[model samples]
Target: MSPTNPSLSPERVRADVAELLGCDPAEIGSDDDLVDLGLDSVRMMTLVERWRAQGATTLEFPDLAERPELGHWTALLTGSAA
Candidate 1:
């Protein structure tokens, strides 16, 4: 699954995060803090591992935890993270 694929878009990422957190995708944004949403260290680790298995290399648990937002996560998944 390449980032260029529609399945890896920010909207998809947002949806995935929403699903994991049990919230609506509209509730997440590019700057939302994931820790504030009830995602603990364990769950964050699971999410990172899942992303890695799905072919994402730029995103780690720390990065996602630090900036738990759709845009940043999408960039990481797409290999556009700085």
Candidate 2:
């Protein structure tokens, strides 16, 4: 697998999210709701743990679940400490 969005880049987040959803990166709009694209609580938590391991310590499952959009997560994850 390719590297994930450890740096929290918007594009990288979108790509990673797309991969997690088993879709093409182009299919994920910046504001598209991830849950609508099939993201469940387990998957959301998995993503949170992966990102946290990659240094996105501030990322929380609830935050991502509340706003499952690339742009929103990008903004949130970008502020996280390594």
Candidate 3:
């Protein structure tokens, strides 16, 4: 599902991350652990870079990796984090 604000869908975000990491988008689950998926610091940075390319100005990898859930990341993307 996408955010209520509808800037982008969780699937789209997952696809973008998968493309940046050179993996299959289907492999990333809403609750999967990114660190367990081999998303090291470098990979996290790569994710941030990709996010920037997609127009996210305030996202940081550490924040996303801390939770690594589609819901959490989607909230961040939508600036719903408080």
Candidate 4:
């Protein structure tokens, strides 16, 4: 199943990231750097593919990797980012 919800919340993003990292959702801070948390290129690409398949087609691995933070990703996914 897709990690993102239809509402596209930051919490969902955090949960997805936590799952990928084999951690808890609470462990993933909204502003935490995923790369610093062991999020490598392969995992990042996997997330991109999964999210894209769930309709986040504009999501790019580079974009996510550039700033691997749940808050920013949530904003991008929900069209709330500047």
Task: Report the lDDT tens digits of candidate 4 across residue range 30-70.
Answer: 78888898988998898788778777766777778778887
Model 4: CA > 4 A from native: 1-7, 80-82
Model 3 over residues 1-82: C-alpha lDDT tens digits? Answer: 3223345556677776677657998777767776677667786777677766766756666677778766577667764531
Whose lDDT is greatest here?
4
Put down candidate 2 lDDT per residue, 1-82, tens digits, no spaces.
Answer: 2223446666666667878899988887767788888988888888888788877776677778877877677777764321
lDDT of 1: 0.66
| Ranking 3 against 4 by lDDT, winner | 4
Name the 10 consecutive residues with the lowest summed lDDT in model 4. 1-10
Between candidates 2 and 3, name the one with more favorable TM-score: 2
Q: Candidate 3: which stretches are off by over 4 Å?
A: 1-8, 78-82
The 10 consecutive residues of candidate 1 with the worst lDDT sum are: 1-10
**TM-score, cand. 1 vs. native:** 0.69
Q: Which structure among the candidates has the greatest TM-score?
A: 4
The candidate with the higher TM-score, 2 or 4, is: 4
List the candidates' TM-scores in order. 0.69, 0.79, 0.66, 0.79
Please report the TM-score between candidate 4 and the true structure: 0.79
Instruction: lDDT for model 2, please.
Output: 0.73
Candidate 3 residue 15 C-alpha distance from true site, Å:
1.0
RMSD of each: 4.2, 6.0, 5.1, 4.7
* lDDT for position 20 in model 4: 89
